[model samples]
Target: MCTETALRRENGDRFCLSTAQAETLLTGAPWRRFLVIGDEVADGRGEPAEGYGHDGWADRVAASLRRIQPGLAYLNLGRKGRLAAEIRSRQLGRVLEFKPDLTALTCCGAELVRDPFDADSVEAEFDRVVAPLRDSGGDVLLVNWFDITRFSPRSSEETERLRIRLRELAERKQAVALRHGAIYVNLAEHPAAADRDVFGADGSAPTMRGHAIAAASVIQGLGAHLTGAGDACR
Candidate 1:
């Protein structure tokens, strides 16, 4: 039972999951070729702090998968600041070429931060990237953006309104995940996302410690599908 047990603590905050624990949870996994595509977060932007997971979360996830399969090939096509259309255009073609058995897609940072949000356009971009991978007959994973605004308290009515929009965005992502039978990890609802320790110095991207938690969450999301004992993707 991979509890949200703290693997270690930094500044009194509990960081969950070590690479070894993730491996234990993912034991018996059969994926070989793995592709990660999306925005910067999917790219795993963050520095490695001592005692926390290093590199990007995707790499951490791959490292664990490697322990189990020992021959996993991982490729990350995520670029920071790439808009949804650009991600769909640039990264996805390479993904098809990789033909991975397992894949992860996350494109939230750009659109969620944009003003005058377009739900339909964002949804379209999501579908464009997600649909093709689904056609490839591989397992797909999706993650929602955490409520970034929580890091900075904004009392403005517009901020509250944007929160509503964020929830709607999560729903849209879930619909896509459900439609394709992909695993969706609802980072938006995870209480730890609101914690300050998980964020980077820039106040936006995840810290490597945050990466550990995210990797654990991915394993946790797969747990139900794999062993029927982890968090529900829906």
Candidate 2:
């Protein structure tokens, strides 16, 4: 059921993960005091080309939650270009120190690129990163790496293999979380929140207004998960 859809690219390559999928991953979880950990996109730091600030999906999810309860606070631990192992090596230790109610780690693409031939390294690092969270009195939420390969045009065989590898990585991460009684959030399935024209003429950073909107989206979703609230402004 988790593998229900394929994310089709402009070049006819297909990957899978949908907004429905993302929502489903969070539906039955008992979440509160959310902490989002992932790459720049998860951190809401979009590149200058994306025409939007990077708040990416976290902002959207957080905003959705706040619409119903205006007083929810979420800690975002996203960094720029943080691969799984790197995140494991750097942030995981500090995150456990905070003892959050709920913590979500979104990762993938970088690991695939960094070690295209060694998938086990990513899995092992994920286990190491998340082990402490489970040991603590916290619900670890694993946010699956979103579809970034689609962003590029190099759809070679190697690229396809990388995509498959990331998918496997997502599954492994989810398993690790589940083994520790944690929730898993998958973002590969979210629809394109940005329109083709959401970018500026130069296509680098999002206009301030655009960043606010993007941040609002992440905040909405996170709020709902954290507070059992409803939708926020679009």
Query: Candidates' lDDT values, in order?
Result: 0.76, 0.54
Segments of candidate 1 deviating more than 4 angstroms: 1-15, 47-50, 153-155, 228-234
Q: Model 1 Cα displacement at 27 (Å)?
A: 1.7
Candidate 2 residue 153 C-alpha distance from true site, Å: 1.3
Q: Model 1 over residues 83-128: C-alpha lDDT tens digits?
A: 8889888888888998988898887677866877888888888888
lDDT tens digits by residue: candidate 2, 7-60: 122112112223343344345444446677777646865434322233355665
Top model by TM-score, which number?
1
RMSD of model 1, in Å?
3.5
Total residue pair clashes for candidate 2? 39
Instruction: TM-score each candidate.
Output: 0.87, 0.61
